[model samples]
Target: MGVFRFESKYAAPTKEQRERYMRGECEEHMFGNDGEIVLVLYDEAAYLKDDLEGVRILFTGASDKRKVDDEVRRLLEEHGQKEQRPDEFESGKRR
Candidate 1:
C-alpha cells in the first residue's frame, strides 16, 4: 500500500494537480507538513462518505484497472455530483 497525497508548501493541490497524481507522474517524493489529504487507501470513507470526500485521484492496491474503475464509478454515483470525469459514457482510455 502507498500513501497517495497531494503535497505542496504553498496551498492545497488544485483539481488539475490531483489529476497529474492520478496519472502517476507527479509526487516524486514526500515531505512533512503538506496540505490537506484528498485520497487514501485505508481511507476515511467511514466518516466522509467516499462520494462526499475530496477528489479521488488514485486507488492503489493489488486491484487491477477494471476494479479501480468500477470503484470510482460507484463512488461518483453515490456522490450525486458530476465533479469527476467519465461524465457521459466510456472513459475512452482503452481500458
Candidate 2:
C-alpha cells in the first residue's frame, strides 16, 4: 500500500481540484500546525459524501471483460430444466 502524509497548512481545494484528485492525478496536502503532508489514495468521493454514509462513488469503469458465455449457457440450461417441471410455471392459457 502507498503511504501518504498530511499537514494542516494545505488550503481547501475547489471542486475542479477535487475532481482532478479523483483521477489519481492530484495529491492533496492536509496541513497541520506541525507540518504539511500529502494524502495518498485520497478518494474525493468519500469527502463529497460527507455525512451521507453508504454513498457510492462514480468513476471510470474497468475495461477487463469476463468471458461468461459458458456460464450463461449453463445457467440457461439449468433454467430450462427448472422450467420443464410443471410447478415452475403457472398453469394458464398462452398465445
Candidate 3:
C-alpha cells in the first residue's frame, strides 16, 4: 500500500459528508467540498479520519502512487485548494 499527503485550507467535513465518505460513496471528492490537508492511503478497507488540522482517507483498494496522487490533486482542485510546495514550508509561508 502507498500513502499520499496533500495540504489544503478548506474547512473540515460535516457529519453527513464524513458518513458518506466512510461508506465509499464519495468518488469525486472525499469530503465533498470540505476538509483541510488530506492523507490518501491505498488499503483494503475504506476509512475516513477527520480532525481539526486535516483528514485521512483509506481507499478501498490498492492503486499506483501516480493514480492516488492524481486523484488527490483532482479533489483539491475541485475544492479550490492548492497543494503547497516544499519551499513554502521551508519559508514558513504555509497556512
Candidate 4:
C-alpha cells in the first residue's frame, strides 16, 4: 500500500468568507499544497457540499509523487472526472 497522506486543512481563507464566493464576487480565493499538489479551496463548506452532492470534487495530489498522483487520478476516473493538468486551467477543473 502507498503511504497515507496527512490532512492539513487550514481555514486560511476563512476571513474571506463564503458570501463572496457564492455571489461570484470573491476577489480571490486561496490555494495550498500537499507536497507538490496544488489546491484552491474557496470555501470548505462549498467544497465539501459540492463533493457530497455529486456536483463536483476537486482532488489534489502531489504532482511529483507517482503513488499520490496515480491514486488521485484513479479517484478522478472513478468519479467520471477528467484529469486536469497541473499548471493549466481547464474548464471544469477550476471554479
Candidate 5:
C-alpha cells in the first residue's frame, strides 16, 4: 500500500468523530492524484458506498518520489500560489 497524503482546507473527521462520516450523514472530499477534489458523501455507517457523491471512487498511486517537489511547484503555479524557495538546510540538517 502507498501512503496517501491528504491536503484539504476542509476539516477531517477525527477517530471519535468518524461515526457521523461512516454513517453517511456527513460529506467529505478527497483529493485525487491530479490534485482535483473527488466529492464524496458519507452514509450513517460512513462506509464509502454507491451513494457517495461526486466522483465515486478514485484509484491513486504514490507521488513520484524523485519528482514530487517539482510536481507540487507546478500545481502551485497553476493555482497562482506564491513561489517558495526550497529548503536549503533540510538535507544538511538531517542527522
Candidate 6:
C-alpha cells in the first residue's frame, strides 16, 4: 500500500532490464537518454508480472518534485486515468 518513485535521465528501460525487472532482480531499469523519465509504482516491490507495464510515467524531462507534481496534476486533468487523490501521497498517489 505504498508508492515508489524513480527518476532518471533516461527515456525508457531496455529489453533485458525489463526482463530483469519482471524477474524481481531490480527495482527499475535505467537505460536510454532521449529525455527524462519518472516512473511511479504503487506496489511495495518490483515483482509485477506486467514487467513495468503496470508502472506509470509521470512525465519526461528534468524537474524537481514540485514541478513534477504540477505536471502530474495537469496530466490528470488532460488524460484522466484511475481516480486518485493528490493528497494521498507525498509525491503522488497510487492508481
| TM-scores for every predicted model | 0.25, 0.23, 0.27, 0.22, 0.23, 0.23
Total clashing pairs for each candidate:
0, 10, 0, 0, 10, 0
Residue-by-residue lDDT tens digits, candidate 3, 1-95 = 43323233344434654454345433332444455434533224333344433544444344533355655566556445433333334655668
Q: Order of all candidates by lDDT, from best down to worst?
A: 3, 1, 5, 6, 2, 4
Instruction: Give me the overall lDDT of model 1.
Output: 0.36
What lDDT would each prediction earn against the true structure?
A: 0.36, 0.32, 0.43, 0.32, 0.35, 0.34
- Candidate 4 lDDT over 21-80, as tens digits, reads 333422223222212223233322223211311232222223322333354445445444
Name the top lDDT candidate: 3
Model 4, residue 50: what's the lDDT? 18
Regarding TM-score, does 2 or 3 come out ahead? 3
Pairs of residues at least 3 apart in sequence or in different chains that clash in candidate 2: 5-37, 5-38, 7-30, 7-31, 7-32, 7-37, 8-31, 8-32, 9-31, 9-32
Model 6 agreement with the true structure over 68-90: per-residue lDDT tens digits = 45544454453334234354447
Residue-wise C-alpha lDDT for candidate 2, range 1-95, written one tens digit per residue: 11121222243445664565455544433322222222223333212111111121222212111212232344346545755777845768877
> Candidate 3's C-alpha lDDT?
0.43
Total backbone clashes of model 6? Answer: 0
- Which parts of model 2 are misplaced by more than 4 Å? 1-66, 88-95
Cα misplacement distance, residue 47 of candidate 3 (Å): 7.2
| Residue 82 accuracy (lDDT) in model 2 | 57
For the record, the alpha-carbon RMSD of candidate 5 to the native fold, in angstroms, is 14.8
- Which model scores highest in TM-score? 3
Q: Please tell me which model should have the higher lDDT, number 2 or number 5.
A: 5
